[model samples]
Target chain A: MTVPALSVQGLTTHFFTRAGVVKAVDGVSFDLAQGEIMGLVGESGSGKTVTGFSLLGLVDPPGRIVEGSIKLNGTELTTLSGSALRARRGREISMIFQDPIATLNPLLTIGQQMQLAIAAHERLGKRAALARCTELLTQVGIPSAEARLRAYPHEFSGGMRQRVAIAIALLHRPAVLVADEPTTALDVSIQAQILLQMRELAAETGTAMIWISHDLAVVSSLATKLAVMYAGKIVEQGPTAALLRDPRHPYTAGLIASLPAMTTPGTPLTQIRGTTPSLLSLPPGCPFAPRCDKQTEACVQKPAMTLDGPRGWRCFHPVGQTAGAPT
Target chain B: MLGFIIQRFIQAVGVMAVMSVIVFFGVYAIGNPIDIVIPPDATQEIRLEAIRRLGLDRPLYEQYFTFLANLLQGDLGRSFVYNMPVLELIGGRLPATLELVLISVISATVLGVSLGIYAGYRPDSWVSKTIMAVSVLGFSVPSFWVGLILILFFAVHLGWLPAGGRGDTVMIWGVAWSFPTLNGLSHIALPAVNLALFKLAMMIRLARAGTREIMLTDTIKFARAAGLSEATILRRHLLKLISIPIITVFGLELGSTLAFAVVTETIFSWPGVGKLIIDSIAVLDRPVMVAYLILVAFLFVTINFVIDLVFALIDPRVRDGASA
Candidate 1:
């Protein structure tokens, strides 16, 4: 079989604070083929963003990747350092942030920031870089791209700034694009437009993308594969359509049940009881065990990530088992 | 932009106008200058002549109007002690003070900002801590005491520099500058450094805080993720982001430096306006004192105006506000 575009195995990132060690991403693993989109769904503090940061070696001090192997097309990234890693960052892998304004420098115009990103990895003259930037803006559905190049970050509205951020990320057609909730900050209509554009861009560029978001609906519409994380670990992983239709993990099933559309119109929405466990002091065995309705005596010990074909889950008693079905 | 500048100019004029009235009345409120001008044993006729000649006999309101009208006519009146035009006295000394302030401000900003960036970039490092410690000392120590200490080390003990006074100078555009000469530079160095220490410390703290804040911003992180080198990221993003605070501090500090150069000038006996003002205040020279106050007020308003313009130019958000 052809090598996957990006493969991560046993990735564990921990943050050492004065209070305690936070296992932000604990033994998470996944693979993405070329041009595929993997939705990483999780609540706040679930280590989804940390996982993205770790892939690019962007984790700051007090937070570090303890054990992990990140491979991009057969080349190991975790072992690289200094210029070696930096060389691959924008050219091979890039990221889109949650806030577009934060991603774009306020002092710099769109063309200047885009040119800097492009020139960081490639040698291009001014005029040529501008031409390429204008084209990228156009591809991102920004009209009057040439004129917009002179506009500063503050000049663009929230949605437009996000589009500019996306255009910048796609400038070099990186092999792997990690988008950390790129559309979550936009209005619903703007969100849909950006999501559609992102899907089209990923397909056209043939770039593997890990779309991290808490919104399952957006992820379901955009992601080909889905990985549901809870308390720093992935509870379930499978094809999006299949996983949404039948989530074997109790947490995944609870998330689907909590969606407003899943219940009858007048009935109160179902919510999973208890909040997500703190990463600094998780419960023994599975981090989600305290909140899992299907927990069993076996759950007192953490279950290994069990793989069945393309599907994987970490739980002693999954929801799909007939005996564990809820009345 | 033009309209904004014009509006600021009008505001500056209004400020100066109000300041002139306050300075005029404030100087009069201080014990009468005539007391110092004429001896107590002098006859009543001599006292009356002195009061009439000095325009002290006029009502406070009329004297203020006359002062304002004379100010418009480029007259700052005559100094009671020196028996010369206050404008000429100030003009002669203005260059020296400006020279000292210019050198001090430039040196302080460059040294402070560079050190601050280095320290702020790695705040936990031992070197940063050491720099911070030194900066704290710079801030806490009084300028006069620091001046004496500098004199003790560089002049009295090592004999490497002069302790006071303006040294040899060359004229540029009819103005004598103390640069490009060993003697002049060495003479100005001690006083300039003494004046700069407090401002330098303040600048370091401002720059450090600004740099720390900017480093954590999302754009900086994006720049890092874009594979830009640390130096490039600093120059392109961090420096620009921190520049607003630095410029603001520089402007305010420069104004205060000009306003409060008395201590440093006295310590070094530098023939700047600060020293002149101190001597005039001693003799109760009303014209000199009043002229000095107005000049300082004008300098402050002008500096703020310039800073506002520069601020708008640097930050697009401010520029947008200005146009809107």
Candidate 2:
């Protein structure tokens, strides 16, 4: 079989704070074929963002990838460090962040910043670099791409800045692109536009993506596959259509049920009970057991991930198994 | 941008106007220079002549207006001690101070910012701790005492440099410069280091604080994610981010040091404006005192204006704010 674009298995990242070891991302595993989009879904603090950072080896001090195997196009990345890892980052696997305003350097113009990114890996002539920057900007739907390159981050509106950030991320058109809530800070109209553009770009470039977000409607609209994370672990994952139609994990079911589209107008939307367990002091066995409506004696002991072809979940009593149980 | 510059220039003129008033009245309050200018044994006629000739015999308001009128005419009156124009007297001594203060502040900024960035980048390292410790010592030690110690260590003990005074001079563009000759460089060294000590500490602290904050920003993270090396990130991204505050302190320190590097100057006996001002004070030279104080105010206003422009140049946000 052809190698997948990105493969991650048993990835465990932890923050070694003074309080304790906080497992930010624990045992996350997924694979994305070329040009595929995998939506990493979770609430805040669910390790989705950390997972994305782990993929790029971008976790700062006090937090690090303590254990993991992140392979990009069958080349192991966890073993790479320092310059080796840095070389691979933007050239092979790039990432765009959540807030465009905060991500781009305020002091630098878009042209200068894009040029710097280009210069980091290859030595391109000045004319070629400018031409490449313009092409990427135009591709990303930035109007007057040539003139816009001279504009600073503050000069661009929120959406425009994010578009610039995306253009930078796609400069080399790496095999894997990990976007962390890139469109969340944008308006709905802009968000839809970016999402559609991103899908087209991924298809054209054959770049796989792990789109991390908490917004189910936004994710479901774009992602081909879905992975639901709760308390630093993936509880359910499968094709987007199959998972949404039949959420095997109770937490995933709750997330699907809470979406505005899933509920009648004016009715109270369903929400998962309780906040995520603190990573510093997680409950033994299943971390989400405290909030699970189908919690049983078996939940006291963590259930192994049960798989059916491409679909898999870690639940003792999955949704359909508990028919007539509390929704 | 032109409007902003014009507005700043008007504000600078307003500042100079207020500074002139304060200096004129303040010098007037320091007792009539005639008492010190004329000998006590001088006859009443001689005393009267001296007072009239010096413009001290006029009413305080008239004397202030005379000073302002003379200032507008580019004549800061004649120095009673030197019998030369006050501006000419100051201009003769200013180059010495300018060269010394420039060397000290520029070297301090370059060295301090580099060390500070390194310290901030690796705060837990022993080198950072040592740098911090040295900065604290720099802040706490008085400049006069530091000046003496510097003399003792470099001049007396090591015998590697001169103890005091501008040793030799070479004329450049009709100005006596001590920097050209090795002997002059040796002479200026101790005094410059002594003047730079406190400012170095300040720059280090400012840069360290700025770097520590900016290092954690998403801007740095994004740069790193773009595969920019740590050195590039620090130089290109961190430096620009931290430069506004550092440049502000640099301008302030440069002005303050140029205006009031008295303790170090006195210790080294370097013939700069600081010495000139002290000597003028002793002789109750009103013209020199008034002119010097006004010049100090003008220097500060000009430096601050330049710094604002620099802030605009480095940061588009500041540029927008200024034009708006």
Q: Pick the candidate with the highest DockQ.
A: 2
Worst 10 contiguous positions by lDDT, candidate 1 chain B: B172-181
lDDT of 1 by residue, A154-263 (tens): 98999999999888888888889999999988899999998998899888999899999998989999999999998888889999998999888888999999998899
Share of native interface contacts recovered by each model = 0.74, 0.82
lDDT, candidate 2, B1-324, per-residue tens: 888999999999999998998888988788878878889999999988888888777888998898888889888888998999988888989989999999999999999998898889899999999999999999999999999889899999999999998989999888899999999998999999998888889888988999999999888888888889998999899999999999999999999999988878889998899999999999999899999999999999989999999999999998998889
- Misplaced by over 4 Å in model 2 are A322-327
Local distance difference test, per candidate? 0.90, 0.91
Summed over model 2, clashes come to 0
Error of 2 at B146 (Å): 0.8
Compared with the real two-chain complex, what DockQ does model 2 have?
0.85
TM-scores of the candidates are 0.98, 0.98
- DockQ each candidate and list the results: 0.77, 0.85
